[model samples]
Target: MISKVIAILLYLAVVMYLGYKGWKTTQRPTDYMLAGRRMSPWVMALSYGATFVSTSAIVGFGGAAGLFGFPLLWLTFLTIFVGVFIAMVGFGKRTRRMGLSLNSHTFPELLGRRYRSSFIQRFAGGIIFLFIPIYAAAVLIGISRILEISLGVPYEAALVFMTLLLAAYVITGGLKAVMYTDAFQALIMGMMMLMLLGGTYYMLGGVTEAHSTLASMAHLMPSKLQLGGMEGWTQGARFGTPLWLVIYTTIVYGVGIGVLAQPQLAVRFMTVHSDRELNRAVLVGGIFIPIMTGVAFTVGALSNAVFMEKFGKISIAMAAGNMDKIIPLYIEKIMPPWFAGLFLLGMFAAAMSTLSSQYHVGGTSLSRDIWENIKGREASVAASRFGVAATVLAALIWAWVLPPSVIARATAFFFGLCAASFLPAYLLGLYWKRMTKGAAVISMVGGFATSMFWLLFVHLKEAKVIGLSKALFGVDSLASLAPKGSAMWLMQWVDPNVIALPVAMLLAVGAAYATQTMQREHVELCFENIR
Candidate 1:
């Protein structure tokens, strides 16, 4: 306990010092919002990777891997290739150039300026301000779980403690503090993950032996999961089964595709100076992402083997069926006691790094996009700080109210929603000169509406929990009314992104063709910095 407390205090000291440094450096709104647009490539890469792979990746989705098995590794691949490589190379270059060309500070502002429509900014900002709390809650739950296991702190206390700590730095230092502290935190996280991976493999007698043992334990899969079509940790779920849809559509496809449109992530692209920085960041981000996510998923899947060997029960069974507890419980029970304190620090870093960015984006969206447009003036720095505090409070409330074992599902929900709502407009706006303001408006509103409609009315997992379909239509999902064996019935298991993203893209294209294009001069100005 003394060791844990000392480590935490020392970590907090470094973090606060960095936050103070950021505050000292910050002078203008640009400094606060974009770190004066002069961050180093290493800092940018580590900050982006740390923010992208948070407690959501390590604790929430890692826990899901405990239940779903090795197939979750596909997400690691996507996060590296699509999230890092394609995002930085394809989208990051354009976003940075265009953001500078337009002097846009926030993601919504970029969209608004790109199309010369303040309404676009306000609407996009409102969406992010309102919905991001749920995603923030997922990260909150992850670190809170870690604290509960590692420190024996009450869950409620952990939630409040983390919120206050993050608010202190993020509100004071803004993006500079977020990125500075993120780079530091990323180093801690990487070291701890390397240790975790090596220790797990060594404990299980080596990679080949561990995987072989897990594969042979297929029959030990919980009856419910087996019925849901999970074949084994190594073999993956049966094709086209209910579990298969949840794993592929929600976990893999939804999150994989969704990373392209995350507001918090997109804003980071605008933080660096040139495409050269982004080019350098690609290699750093590529390596960092795999270390964070690959280790988490591998250790999560292998935890089942470790637990079964030691405790005579599967991972979820040992955690008493709470998937969210699997990873934390594994670390607490299986790893050395000294390692637990270090792991707690690492998880704390992960949670704080992500939460700070979420709070920053949420605050900027409110102040820079919504409030500024509403008042027809620039909001004060004090106002932005107020918005950050408000975001922290909202996420804390969500963390308290959200159901247990919801971390992974909530993360995926937000990711999929962002993909559906923003990906169409954001992606096309970057390249297609012909994309009209009307098309962007239609696609953004239409995509968000469709995603929400499906979540509340069609998708069984969310609909059942949200219960709006039950309240209105007396069914858990609208698809429940269809013949059980039919295609419509299967729609219940499909993710909202599968339905909404395509709908959004189609809306964007169709509306683009139907509407008048932006004036040629404005289009040329927007594309001036592009090759």
Candidate 2:
């Protein structure tokens, strides 16, 4: 524990100092929000990867591995193939040129200018303000969990400390700080995990023994561990997490493809001086993301070998509703105190790297996108600073109210929401000449509503406002069919993305097409920027 405390403190000092250095570079809104438009390709790629991986990849997705098994590896492929490769060659260069041409600051600004629709700016900005919290809160949840496990801190206190630390660099230096610290933080994440690879193998006897034990656990998957124990299990199996095709294409692909639409990430394009730099960054991102997320996912999943071998069962939760503790629990038990400290620092890097990006994004969405847009010009310093304060305060309030149990799904919920709401419109506006302002708005609205309805009414909602089986068909839920068989019934399954996203896309395109004839100005503006 002493070692863990020292590790975190040292890591924090280094990160905060980097933040201080970044602060020296900010003199204008562009510098604060877009790093003075002078970032190199390596910084750009690391910044993109930092926000992409985050605490979600570690605590949330890592726990998913412990829960689901090995198929989630599909994300690594989608992330690399679609996210980095396509973004650098196709989206990144185009967006950088187009954004400079339009002098756009935020994503919605670019879209609004491109499509000649003020509504797109406001609507996308609103979504950024709203759905982004779920993702940000997920980072807080992961950070809180790690802190609690390592230092015996309460989840609430851990959350406060973590969120505050994140807000420090974010509110002060904005994008410059986020990118610089992400570069540094990404490095920490890599080093710590590299160290853990050694510690993990030594503890588990070796790589061969580790795989043997995990295989044994796969065989021993208790009924509780199968596809029907949790309410989600049956649904996951019914549609198979939809990943055989949909998850990779929609949820994962949507994210990789959707990076173009991400306001915070898109802003990175505006900062780099040249397309050549963006191309250089792609190589960096390719090397980094695979190491950080790929390594964590592998170790977190394979650690189950040690888990089952030692405890006779794999338990991701050290306690009820405390999923964040899973990785920390395994690390503390499986590694020496000093190594556990390093692991904790790595975990902190994962959280901070993502949190800093979120704070930068949230503050800019509120300040630059929303506040400045309505006035028809740039915002005042007081206004930007006020936005910074409000963003931090809002995150702090959420951290205070968040319960342990709600954290995990909230993380997934946010990512899915982003994919649904922004991906279609942003991508179309970028790549499709015919993509109209009408189409952009329709897609955003459709994706947002579909994802929300699913989470509240179908997936996470306990009340079952309209029974899934009954709503889609005449059959009842699994509860109704339980007596007839083992209750892993067909109608029992519900995949929210499958149900919601497609509906939203259909709504978006249909509405846009119907309205396109009247919105030529909007369509022309989008056309001017798309290439």
Best by lDDT: 1
Q: Tens digits of per-residue lDDT for model 2 on 415-446?
A: 56766777777666676666666777778777
Q: Which candidate achieves the best TM-score against the true structure?
A: 1
Query: Considering only N, C-alpha and C atoms within 3 Å, which residue pairs clash in candidate 2?
Result: 114-525, 114-526, 442-508
Per-residue lDDT over 224-302 for candidate 1, one digit per residue giving the tens place of the 0 to 100 score: 9999899999889998888999999999999999999999999989999889999999999999999999999999999
TM-score of each: 0.99, 0.87
| lDDT (C-alpha, whole model) for all candidates | 0.94, 0.68
Q: Which stretches of candidate 1 lie over 4 Å from their true place?
A: none
